[model samples]
Target chain A: MAFEDKLSMILTIGILTSSALMLIGIAAILIQGGAAGHSIKSLIAANTTVNTRTLTLQDAFSGLSGITAIYLGIMVLASLPVLTVAALLTRYIGRKDNLFIAISATVLFDMLVAIFLIPYLLH
Target chain B: MLLLLLVAAGVLAGFIGAITGLGGGVVVVPFLALYLGVPIAYATGTSLISTIATSTGSARSYIKERIANMHIGVSLEIGTTLGAITGSLIAAEVYALHLQYIIYILFGLVLFGSSYFSIRKLKMKNFVPGKADWSTKLFRLNGSFIDEATKKKINYHGRRWLLGLAIMFIAGMLSGLLGIGSGVLKVLAMDSAMTLPIKVTTTTSDFMIGVTAATSSGIYWERGFLQPLLIAPVVLGVLVGARLGSKYLVKLNSRVVRYLFIVVLIVLGSQMLLRGLGVF
Candidate 1:
């Protein structure tokens, strides 16, 4: 398949998966009446301390609760762009498009640094 | 009830954004921060995440249509990603210092400035390609797309790669700082500096926004600015609304929509500025 076709497919699948997880998470939160050990009211409160910084990905996955599902969904959504860039990098490498390969690699590298390195450095 | 209201706001922002070609992030931040009284940091985080939804949701069609130039988008991502990282760090500092007023003022200025681009876009027609310089050849910044409106294949090449990249960096910074897609600046960089086609710029901007937002979203996520409960409804609503709006975009008179949204931007921009100045 063409690169564009692959990209479109990746995007479509990513969005569908993420949205489904979010909706299911919401439904679960409503049905279960709470998530991540917090009541619905507290969870949705403006000044609530429950956030990604407080909730680890391990915790988000350890329980099948609504908040965890939503966290997983958000993770999937956030990864889509990185996935797209990685795909682009692979395609460019396959075609031996040196300039484009470099461009794609640089972008992917920057994103990885932001995602992984910056957090550690900040702390 | 709050969840429902948040969803409704997302839908409205997405609808208006789609029709206006502004994207949802522009509308999301102001509404969430100003009207809903969400903190600026969280509002921007939510807006950034919701932006990814709109970007990914619309990317399929844009990519399929081949109006979006992936090569250009990827190239530009180099600048935007770096800018996003810097901007996100700056935002973290600003928020920490309780200097959110600066962000509000900057966002207001960005909104007010975008009106000029929107009005300029209305007057723009029949793009003529400029002389392709060395950077264009080196970067391979040329592509041809079949214009649906004219049914003619339009071949175009970008110039001033450095200038476009510089503008893209600033665009990326604003996106990370303000939690917006910063499509206006991206479009301006491509449309004016790079001299690409409007269709190409708009579509390519859409393609690039997800990666740009994602770049900063990582920082925001690490900072705990991403609230799962707050973001879920907004993302879902924006995806739905943007989908519906895009489907109906061809049928609606875009000029009318643009005029209406320009007014909205002006009002929102002033409101944010006034709020920042403690006048509201």
Candidate 2:
């Protein structure tokens, strides 16, 4: 397959898998009366105030089997773009396209800074 | 039930966004914040996540159809990503100062501004680039795509990379600050300033938005705005809707999409403005 085809395949697969996980997690949450001990009503309330500050990574991982499946699903969704960019980088490297490599690298660097460095700097 | 509501809204937003190549963040933010009573911050966070899903999902078909110009998209991302970081930092400051109303107001203005331009440019004529300069030759900013509407092969090249880069920087900053895909601004930059075809511009912007949104999302996550329960359904709904929407885009007339976009922008813009002014 060509590069664009491969890239599209990667994106489709990533989105489909993550979306399925999220759907399962959301269904579980609704059926199980919410995740991490919150009731479904509270969890789904229009004005509910759940956020990253209120929810921890550890909390998300621990509750996936029980209630944190949604968090895990979102985690997958968030990471997929970065993964796709990485795929682009690898493709460029194989083709020896310096311009694309630089471009993809810069974007990846920006993503990394946001993911790891920014949070560390803030706290 | 509320989760279901979110999914339903996401579906509508995604459908419109994918067909128009606007990425749906524009709709999701206003729908959630103004209509659904979700806090604006959370609405933006959820919208950004959904933006990623829609962009990524729709981008697949756009790429396959060869409507997206990867050269242009990748070249422009450098400015956007850097601008996103700067914008997110500024956003953090704005949020800290409890001046989130500014975001609301700015969002309204951007929507209005872009809608006006889109409406003006809604004439179904294809844009013709005048000449390729040094920047075009340096970047090799040329490609071809089959226009589904005309069913003709459209050969195109973009020029004025400097202007496009500058506009994209602003677009990125807006994306980060407002937690939107900022596809309107990006498309305007490419379509008008860089003189790329509207279809190519829109699809390339769609292809580019996911990276920009993802870059800013990390900050959103750390800031405690990314709520998983809120995002899960939006992501799922948007991805599915965008896929369906992209399929239909091939058959739909460009003018029809622009008209719909104009209506959505005006309604959402007015509402956000009212909310910002405390009129509602």
Candidate 2, residues B25-128, lDDT tens digits: the string is: 98899888887888878888898889889889888888877788888988898888888888888888888889979989999999999999998787637567
TM-score for each of the candidates: 0.94, 0.96
- Candidate 1 deviant stretches above 4 angstroms: B19-21, B248-261
- Give the per-residue lDDT digits (tens) of candidate 1, residues B1-280: 8799789878876676565456688788888888788888888999999988877777667787787889889999999999999899999899888898999899888988977777776775558788899989888899998765556788999999999999999999999898888887887799888988766776788778889999998789888888888899999998888787655543544356557657877888888888888897
Clashes of each: 0, 1
Tell me the tens digit of each residue's lDDT in model 1 across A1-123. Answer: 888888888888889999999999999999999977788887886667788888767777777899877987898998999999999999999999998988999999999999888987876
lDDT of 2: 0.84
Docking class of 1: high
Highest DockQ model number: 1
What is the fnat of model 1 with respect to the true interface contacts?
0.79
**Chain B TM, cand. 2:** 0.97
Write out the backbone clash pairs for model 2.
Answer: A63-A68
Backbone steric clashes in candidate 2, count: 1
